[model samples]
Target: MVAFLDEGGMVDFTIEYELTPDEVGRALHRGLKLQLRAVRLAVPTILAVSGITCLLVDAIGLGVGMLAGAVLFPFVLAWSARRLAKRQLTYLCVPTTLRFTDDGYEYRTDQSATTMRWPLFGRVVSTPEFWLLFVGKQCSAFLPRRAFTSEQQAELDGFFAARQKAGAL
Candidate 1:
């Protein structure tokens, strides 16, 4: 299944929805809240890890070890935080049109569309950025607000609610 969100018939602050069979790949997208949390966690984790490493190295009389850890810790932490944030955006924040079918849902973004089957759906979680349909431990497809208009969002939300009730999700 496939879905398309066109811009031609767009209304002010309105979103459009359509379904198609072709699959497009997903993109990098992350929620502001999740990104912030990840960043917040990174600082403490980095400091702790670096502090421990520095102390251990100092006790061992390895002066370079402390210097290395101090220098590398912040860089590694920043990189990790950035990477995780990017992953969240790619797997959970990017905009896409989702089409539901017997197999799974087809998520279409500007770059590509990808199929996310039911078995891959560990759970469905929602955030302001998107409705995350988790496929694996950390894999997900992001359905952004841009995918639907305010009215359409309500309709789609109702549709998913019904599906959940019927155990069709």
Candidate 2:
């Protein structure tokens, strides 16, 4: 198990696991849903308008096309997101470990390791299952809530709160 010592002399928790494809896919999909709210709404709205226009103009072909697109678009989006997530996770196939501390965080993989200071994250987003740390508009790292014990989770929550209050994230 990996660990880190904070400035307060407390040992921070470590999480070690191989991230599954499903987890990555779900996270990606969730992020897309949150970030692309307008797109999500526009797709359906446009499809509905197309269908209504076709009906008003008595064009069966246009109506069928809109219907087909409405039915197929979501499946296409999900499939594409899953494929991209799978490709991204292939590079992270090795067992990965993350150590969280008050000052920063460190991640280790079979191939390499890196440490990042807290200020490097421009934003911190908390989802139901994971905490996504963003650098600019891209998510830099994700921490699964299940990886930590209750006490460790509390420590992490406090750490995030302090960072937010300090305008570090």
TM-score of 1: 0.46
Best by TM-score: 2
lDDT per residue as tens, model 1, 75-129: 6755664665554444444454566544566666686777666656655556554
Q: Quote each prediction's TM-score.
A: 0.46, 0.78
* After superposition, candidate 1 runs with Cα above 4 Å error: 1-98, 101-103, 108-113, 158-169
- Give per-residue CA lDDT, model 2, range 1-169, as digits (tens): 5445568776576889777777777777776666666776789779978987897899988887897887777788778878878888875656988877767888899888999998888877787687888787776677777777766767677778778888988
Candidate 2, TM-score vs. the true structure? 0.78
